[model samples]
Target chain A: MVSLELKRVVVTGLGAITPLGNNVSQYWQNLLQGCSGVGPITLFDASQHNCQIAAEVKGFDPSDYLERKEAKRMDRFAQFAVCASLQAIADAGLEINEFNAERIGAIIGTGIGGLKVLEDQQEVYLTRGSDRVSPFFIPMMIGNMAAGLTAIHTGARGPNSCTVTACAAGANAVGEAFRLIRHGYAEAMICGGTEATITPLCVAGFAAARALSTRNHEPTRASRPFASDRDGFVMGEGAGILVLEELEHAQRRQAHVYAEIVGYGMTCDAYHMTTPIPGGKGATRAMELALKDAGLFPNQVSYINAHGTSTLANDVAETLAVKQALGIHAEKVAISATKSMTGHLLGGSGGIEAIATAMAVATDRIPPTINLEDPDPACDLDYVPQLCRRQQVDVALSNSFGFGGHNVTLAFKKLKG
Target chain B: MNKQEVLEKVKTIVAEQLGVAPERVTPEANFANDLGADSLDTVELVMAMEEAFKVEIPDDEAEKIVMVQQAVDYISQVAN
Candidate 1:
């Protein structure tokens, strides 16, 4: 029997290509300054569409990180994954050569991978002919191609998989990678989420479902989590990646540890396809499970990076969930929804938010929930409204809920001497 | 179409599919060795040729047309 001794996992590196900025530092700074990244939709001609706003990652050229031939073969989501993974690998400074390549792995999750290519190919098949479709269409549009392409680019050949758990995909990916290292399957893992689905079909579908915010004129203040006049979530595109190294591996290499990952808990509501459970029952249990997994008390959780997607239903329900999970201590926890600035990256949101949570644990300065000028009466907790605060945070939790009733909570603790 | 026209069109297709420059797509250049095209690119290149010239270069024929000149010649012959 293989001994499954749990090893401590630490976040050694972080990378992000978000709507706020292309790198982690810039994204962090913008989040701290309460800057909104939402803007007019320019990826396509959205004039005919109802929702004409999104949080698109601006000025990201694939040539900066990928070779021309390599870039041409990948879908936009895969490109984002590869770029962010490479960035994370570089930031970790842990070399991946012939010797150490077999010990490292990657898991990149995406909500909808290659939707743009699928839509484009369908058009080509209709307008042109079926045989005229490019041979790369199938491979380009698959969700797992992100992890597949990342491995080919970086030469990390351990275990790899892609999680498609909608909004919880990123957090799920990090959790799975943590398990892989904890169980001694691999030494380290590159994990996170990437999503580039601000295309016409995705936008049209979300708009039809009434899941997207229609505040075109006021795109900046549209995503108001825990606010009274809040609307639906604004579609955002980008990727966030983190390097999870075993404690011994990270310490031996003298890695700059951001924070120690203590616990990961996930549960499914099993109730709806597009809506979360009423009163946040599943989400509440997810938080409790994470606390139990980490062997920590509710009072120890000083901050929470709420999944708060700024939707009417999600805000109220998540508020109820947090209150239920933390009991009386929920009122004291400083919770902030970074989605107010980054505008919900869907699957990619968890990755960037995890980075945010780890940063909060490492630095003790939490990013604010911007655009929360009017807090909802039901949400009476301190949202760290509109301003970054300096506080001594010992433990942090990142909560992510997906469309498929998936709820994930990741606990990060400030590494002490 | 004549061989020169076929060559020019093939050069454009190769440049677009293989992500290479038109100037580098000489008649003697091999698709895999010179242009760094794997099996997937070759398949797509053949599909593009079929679409552009309205000629079905079968799988067996595609395997033989590994060089730029072979593709241009094959298309010129098939089209003409």
Candidate 2:
């Protein structure tokens, strides 16, 4: 018979390769400073595309983390996942020796995996014959390769899996990993999300959907979340990985706990394909469920890393969702739209936002929502705009909603000990 | 291509594909054993050799190329 008692989970390590910066320290520093990572698309010539601005991960050299042979075998997304996972594992100092190798696991998520590979290989297949196509094409383009490659690089032999729930994938991965540790499935999990879909096809596809900002001249100010003039989200790329350990396991290993992950809530609109349900009811329910799961009152939430995608729909809907979930305290809460600085990282957003929330909980500082010079009347919540806010953040929530109306909220609390 | 010319080109490909130094990719070096070319790596290496030499290496003939020298010999014999 399984024990009814649930184990406490804590975030022992964090790693990120984000648009604002590569590592967690750099990213967090830049975020607090309200640095804008958006620029003219350099990965590809955007002269012909309708949407030209993107928040591409700058100055990331795969050789810094992986050998040439191994890096060459994986796609850019998988490379980011492996590098972030390695960084988090090192930060945790949780050695995967012969005794504990089988007790750890991995779960990495992605929105669209390796579009560059698919586009490149498709060209090869069309111009040359099928035989000329690369043998690594399939493995490199698939979404699950991130989890698979992370596991292979980290030697995590327990339960290995991947979540492909669009933007909510990263949150789902983290939540499921938390579940594994909360129950008796695994002692630790290297879990999060990675995305590198700033390719021509992705840009064109998003442009066709009118889901991207077309502010080519002013790239830095393009992703103006909760702003009245906000057009749409600017495409961004990166990865975030966290090492979640059981409370007892972390105590035994003497791992430094950043914060405690107390709750996760997932919901689907079942209403639309891309647009969120009216008033973001699904998101409201998700936030409510997360608070309920954590056994915390709405007034207890101090900071919220809002899924502020800068699109009119997301900003307005997310604002309403917060109001509905938290009622009067929603106005008092310090909400942040870090997407203004990092841009929307798609699947990677949830992972990095969770890190941001945990950082707020641990450090008592909230990063600002840059470029929010004019707030939309509909989104009149305290959106810690213009500058970072130094406040007492005891409990924080990170929200991530995906293309499939997938809503996920993760609750994090400051470790009192 | 001459046998010596093919050997140089093959050595360069092997070195690049296997992520090893040129000195490590000797003519007698086995792709898998010495150069650490896994099964998939060996396939890609053969594809690269086939493209460079302008020759189609049949699957059966490709399987026999266990060493670097074998690739050079096959390309040298097949290339116009």
lDDT of the candidates, in the order given: 0.92, 0.92
List each candidate's DockQ score. 0.76, 0.87
| C-alpha lDDT of residue A99 in model 2 | 89
Residue pairs with colliding backbones in model 2 are: none
Residues A1-417, candidate 2: write the lDDT tens digits: 123688899999999999988899999999999999999999999899999999999999889999999999988889888998999999999889778878899988898888899999999999998998888999898999998888788888988988998989999999999888888789999999889999999999999999999999999999999999999999999999999998999999789999999999999999999999988999999999999989999999999999999998999999999999999999899999999999888888888888998889889999999998889999999999999999999899999999999999999998766
Q: What is the C-alpha lDDT profile of model 1 across A1-417, one tens digit per residue? A: 123688889999898999999889999889999999999999999999989999999999889998888998999988888998988889999799899888899998998899999999999999988777888999999999999999999999999999999999999999899888888888899999999999999999999989888999999998889999887999998999999999999999999999999899999999999888889999999999999988999999999999999888899889999999999999899999999999888889889999999999988999999888889998889999999999988999999999989999999998765
lDDT of 1 by residue, B1-80 (tens): 78888899999999998898899999999999999999889999999889899899988998999899999888888788
Clashing pairs in 1: none
Off by over 4 Å in 2: A1-3
Return the TM-score for each candidate structure: 0.97, 0.99
Interface RMSD of each: 1.3, 0.7
